[model samples]
Target chain A: MKAIITTTGKDKTGILAEITRYISDANCNVEDISQTIMQGNFVMIMMIDLSRSPLGFAEIKEGLDEIASRSELSIHIQRAEIFEQMHHV
Target chain B: MINSKEILETVRMVDAQNLDVRTITMAVSLIDCISDDGKVCAGKVYDKISRYSANLVKVGNDIATEYGIPIVNKRVSVTPVSIVGASSGAFTEIAKALDRAAIENGIDFIGGYSALVQKGLTDAETRFLKTIPETLAATERVCSSVNVASTKAGTNMDAVKMMGEIVLDTARLTADRDSIGCAKFVVFANAVEDNPFMAGAFCGVGEGECTVNVGVSGPGVVEQAIRNIESGDAADLTAVAETVKRTAFKITRAGMLIANEAAKRLGCKFGIIDLSLAPTPTVGDSVAYVLEAMGLESVGCHGTTAALALLNDAVKKGGVMASNHVGGLSGAFIPVSEDLGMISAVERGALSLDKLEAMTCVCSVGLDMIAVPGDTPASVISAIIADECAIGVVNNKTTAVRVVPAIGKGVGDRVDFGGLLGGAPVMKTNAYSAEKFISRGGRIPAPIHSNKN
Candidate 1:
């Protein structure tokens, strides 16, 4: 299964490193990454493969939620197929 | 991979626009549960409902989590109890069984305490119809409906008159709770078999054993999409219709995905995706607001019907392309109490019963969640149902009435059913009597179109 994790907040140092560290620790592979900064606001979308992850969807989401709560950020994890279904024919 | 912007847009629809799978109803057939003895039939009905929907809630939650989309309700729709309980004539017993099974499965409501008497009522069906008022009052989660008219069979004036009295009886029975019982009951014309929303859903005889039906809603998303149109094209109805169609296409596609996933997990057939933009009391999630955003001053004002007609047609056009099977009430809903904008419109006297009736000609369903004075005559209520049925029959569409006669409450008073049922102010009805007309009881013959077949 694949999931898209979105992060949005203020731009800051080491934000990318911190988020990747958590995903790497969970044994998930980040297949694609895109990030942009607009007027000091940071936004990033990561497409990750969860097939090899030891953690369940809920467990992985909770960890990301905890990280988001500790920072000025909003994080959401959703199955990638939802995007494919809605945006494509 | 899908583009980043598209992913973000989908997330925004869920997080901010109130886009959701309104209900994922499992249609369970009770044809095998019929028996000669009332108690034995009721027992079988209970067992079948419980067994089929045992994992409904858990699977709904799992899908919600995985997709990050809110699934508001998990429910069950069974074969009409009148047919299943005809031999036993155990209408109340079967209703009680449905209520218990709904609770056991952790689902909100179980529909199908219903009868199809568009042509005429059978002996057992007539007996079952009379139990509706008491059955609704006795059960908390049992929803009931009666189809009294159809284009092919025309309107059954006899059943229509009976339903009018039944509605009043239900209101009086549950008067202590502001006549909440009527909120769980509906009267229909040209009723669809696979409707997932209630109090109108029932597994018609035409349906197979079991299937998953999904009703998706996204009025807020549609409203916002129209709002985002360039100012240069703001006054253009063509642009508005285009925007609405595109948004509805996206919403319906999401629904198809959820319906397929739910049926796969539940080991049932994927029945259909009800392409309806159903509203909720939540502020932005209103169908009325969608119309208002399309440049209407109020939902009931003069051009309201035109705006609603455009919206309803655009939704179906867009939705039909996204889903393989688009059934149920596939258009924009305009229920008063369940929509914040509609409630506001009524409070300001900008909306009225007459205007609502006109609007129903273009909406997915008819005069829903409206409240009238307790003193409103049963004949007048029947007249209202008959008029709405006439529109559905002539136009070849489905329409229904779920009005609540607020017992002991007069005009200007409000009846609150809370949660998704919402609340509505008691609006005045026409004072003229329809007693003589109602007294002429018989089937309103099928329309001329019926002869074509």
Candidate 2:
């Protein structure tokens, strides 16, 4: 399954490193990455393939949520199909 | 890959604009649960609901987490209990069972403790209607609705008269709770079978064994979308309608995805998506605010009905093609208590009961979640229902009355139900009595348009 992981917060050091390390540890593959600064905040969108991950979708979300709460960032991991359904169709 | 901006837009809609699947309602038909013995039937009803919807909450939560969108409620709607419990005359007992099942399964509210007496009533239905007040007061999560009129059958003046007394009785019974019982009951004209919103949803006789209907809401999203339009073009009604339609299409598409996935996961037939811009008490997430954003000084002002008409029509136009099946009360909801802007308008003395009645002609529902003075008579309440029914019947649309007569309370007072049910200021009803009209108990003949056959 493919999903999108979006991270948004104030600019901080090692933000990408922290996220990628966590993603790799979960056995998920990053398919694409886009990062930018918008309206004075750091924004990153990662399209990730979760087919290889042993962890369930809920478990992965919980881990991401823990990172978000600790780092004061807004993080969301959602099935990519939702975007395709909303935007493409 | 989807563009970055569109991805963030979806995220912002949820994170900032309160876009959500308002409800994931599993409609369970209780036709097979019927038994001549009321107790036996009640047992079967409970068992079927508990078994069929055992995974509803879990699946709803799972989808909410996976999709990163809020699923506000997980509820169940069953075949009208009046039909299921009629043979046994065990209406209240079945109400208890529905309430128990709701609590046990972690469901929000169980609907369809209802009857369909649009033309006339049978002895069993009449007996069942009498149990509503006590039953509503007794149950914690059971919701009741009565269909007293329809375009095809005209209006049942007798049922309307009875419902008026029943609404007051319910208010007095639950007076301690700010007459909250009335919040769980609604009277409708031209009620739909597939409505996922409550307290009006019921798995109608025409529905299949089981289905999953999704209600999507995003008043804030639509409001923000309109607000995002350039200020110069904001004055243009055509531009406003276009924006609303496009926003509605996106919202409905998301709803379609959720509904189909929920049904697939729950192993049930997929029902329609209700594209209602339902409001919450939160400041930015209000349907009234959407109207206000459309250049209205206040929601109940002179041009409010026209604005609501355009809004309601555009929503259906945009949403119809996004989902294969679109049913339920699919338009803008203006439940005063559940909308912060509406509550504020009433408090500011800008909105009134008469204006609300006029607004319902073009909106999704009628006189919803409004509170009236305790001294209001049942005949007046019946007259109110009759007026709304006349609008619905004559116009071939659905209208409903869910007014709460706050016992011991008068105009300007507030009755709070908290959470999504919110609260409302007790508005004044007219001083005139309609006892004579309501006393002439019979059916109002069907409108001429309804004579299609």
Candidate 3:
């Protein structure tokens, strides 16, 4: 069970640190991270293993609400199978 | 790792556009439940439905939560009641039992209060067909259908006439709710057995003992994708199709996952995924909006059918690879009342019934969710059915009629069906009666195209 965690918003310091702390608290191991700046917005994508995570997707969504709202970031986390189903097949 | 753009695109599809699995339909065969005694048979039918669909709604919600997508409806289809209730003439009891099962199991609606009379009517079928108006008026979740025509067997004008009167009776009997009972009945031509959408889903006689089918709906996603990719002069018809095909592939895959999980949880075999761009009353989620994305001025415009043909074919090309088996009406549905764009077009005089009939030849479902004047003659209604049926029969596609003749409502009046069924402005019908032609009561012979066999 792999999932993708993505955030897009204005650039800021401690952005990666804040995201990493949330992942650790949710007990999900982040395997990869990529960041880019496009059209004056900061975009970050993370690959994580939800298989061993203590939190379910709904619970993770609940826990990320404050981080997303306070940081003014549009965040989305869902199973990677949705994307792989389209692109790979 | 998936690309950042792709992840963002999916989020937009889910969060902004109303992408959803329209239905997860369990096709439960009642072959084993039929008996000589009406009471025992009705009991058996109820027991079988409850046994098979006990976990249907639970499993559907679980999958929706896991995938983070909404599964809008969970329903069941059974063997056509004409056959299941033939021995004892227990059609009403059987309908009641199906409704009880749907309520108890949390299924939205149960279909297959239906009869197939393309060639001719059997004694049992006539008896069952007589009970449709009363049964539908009495029950909340039972849908009934009658197949009045087919290419191979030709049109049964007798059945068509009976269906017209029955539809009128249903409307009058349920007139208190804006004649909404008529919305639950469908008259079909070349109707497929594996349809997962209502008011036309029924488990075919040839199907297995039990199967699970899924109907995937996402007109808004396709519309949004078109909006995102559109640029000046660089994009053309072919590019538009590729975009729709790609989006449809993704939607179909998501639906298949739910179908597999739900079928597994309920201990049934997977049947098929209906690849239809079913619309809703919501503004953005209209099939007409998707057509407008292809640069059409209105859905009933001259070039609408060509654009729809492209969209319908593109969706199939994209969805075909994602599912193990694809059945039902696998194309775009242009139900007028359920689509905001179509409703606006009709209300503003940009669309008409004649043009809509032309559009149905290239779409999945035909002449669907349209409301006509209250005094529209039954013979005229039969003529409409005959015309739509001919399109399906000659073209070898599945098409159906679910017109509501709003009792005491005429042109420009809107009838509210209150939910996903939506509301429709009463569109004008052909004033010239086809009664003289319809009065010639016999099957219209199959066209030359159907002579392949």
Candidate 4:
């Protein structure tokens, strides 16, 4: 299964490195990356393949809990079908 | 590649706005389970439900986890028990067994403890009908419905009268619980098969052996879509329609994905997607709030029906294209007790039973979840059913009445069902008696045919 990681909040240093580190540690590969700053608020979306990931979806979510709270960002990881189905059709 | 803006937007829609798949219902036909012996029939009924839908809740949860959209309810709808148990007279005897099956399978509610008597009732049907109060009072998770009218068959006034009295009996039977038993019972005109929503959903004989269906709900998301832009004059009504259409498309798409995945996993037939903007007691998740977001000062005002017509049509237009099949009462549901917006609208006198009757002409259900005075006569309930059925029969649309006769509670009081059924504010009803009309029990013939619009 493929999933999307969306991060939205105020911008700060080392945000990309922090999120990618977690993804890499989970043995997931990021196939696509899109990041931008909209009106001083940072927004980033990473498309990752999770079929071979070492950590399960729930465990990986738990692994990212600390950084999310510390950064005061709203981060969500969801199956990509939600976006694919809604936006395309 | 899917973009970031839509991703965050969808997440926000779920995180803040209440966008959910209202139900993932597995319709298991109990025709094969019918037996002349009542005890044998009950055993087969329980076995079939438990065996077929054992994985329903698990699959529902797995889909919710994978898609990250809240799947609010997992339910089962079966073949109407009346026809299944006609010869046995053990109709009420089956309620507890079905309830046990529901609990064992972890299902929220099981529907289709029902009968269809639009044209006429047999001896078995009439006997089965009288057992409804006991069925409802006895079962913990079973819901009941009866179809008393249809366009082709006309209105069954005799059945209507009996159901009115039955509705009262159900209320009085469960009076200690604020007459919550009536909340589980609904009277329908032109009731459709394959409905996935509870208190009305049933698996018709025409349906296949087994089918899985979905009901999608997203009133708050539509409200957010409209609130994103300015609410202009009548000229902007077109824009409102377009916005609602687009929002419904997305909501229905999400529901379809869940239904398809669940069916694929369980090896069941994928049935229709019911595209309805069903509301809950939650603050922002309400159909009345969507109307307010459309710039209607109040829901039951002069322009309310027009606004609702736009909503109902656009929902169908957008929803039809997103899913392979669409069935059920695929429109907006306006149950007063289940919606905070409608409840407050009634409490403030901004909405009335008369206005709700008018609104139902353009929406999916009629006089739903409304609380009337304890002293309301059975004839009055039958009269209300007659008027609503006339609308459905004439317009060729589905309408229903699910009013609660809250015993010992008059107008200005409230009956709370907690959870999903929510709480209803007792609203003013017409005092005029319809005893003479209802007492003359005879069928109202079908309406004249009209061409497709």
How many clashing residue pairs appear in each of the predictions shown? Answer: 0, 0, 0, 0
Candidate ranking (lDDT, best to worst)? 2, 1, 3, 4
lDDT of 2 at B182: 98
Provide the lDDT at B6 for model 3. 75
Top model number, DockQ? 2
lDDT of 3 by residue, B289-402 (tens): 999988988878889889999999999988897887989888999898899999998987889999999998999889999999989998988889999988988888888999
TM-score of 3: 0.95
lDDT of 2 by residue, A6-79 (tens): 99999999889999999999999999999999888999999999999999999999899899999999999999
Q: Least lDDT summed over 10 consecutive residues: which range in candidate 4 chain B? A: B228-237
lDDT of 1 by residue, A10-43 (tens): 9988888989999999999999999999688888
Tens-digit lDDT track for model 4 on B1-453?
A: 787778987898898899989999999899988889999999999999999988999888877877888899999999999988986778977777789999999999999999999999989899889999988998889999999999888999999989889999999999999999999899899999999998998899999988999999999999889888774444388888998999889888888888899899878999999999999999789999999888889888889988889999999988997887989988899999999999888988899899999999999777799898877899998898899999888988999999899999999999999998999988777898888889889898877673334
TM-score on B-chain, cand. 4:
0.98
Pairs that collide, model 1: none
Residue by residue across B335-443, what tens digits does model 2's lDDT show?
9999999999999989999999999999988889999998899999999999999999999999999999999999888999999999999998889888999999999
Residue B261: error of model 2 in Å?
A: 0.6
Share of true Cα-Cα contacts across chains kept by each model: 0.72, 0.85, 0.54, 0.74
- Please give the lDDT score at residue B212 for candidate 1: 99
Name the TM-score of candidate 4.
0.96
Model 2: per-residue Cα lDDT at residue B193: 98
In model 1, which runs have C-alpha deviations exceeding 4 angstroms? B233-235
User: What's the lDDT of the predicted structure labeled candidate 2?
Assistant: 0.94
Off by over 4 Å in 4: A10-14, A62-72, B231-235, B450-453
Off by over 4 Å in 2: B233-235
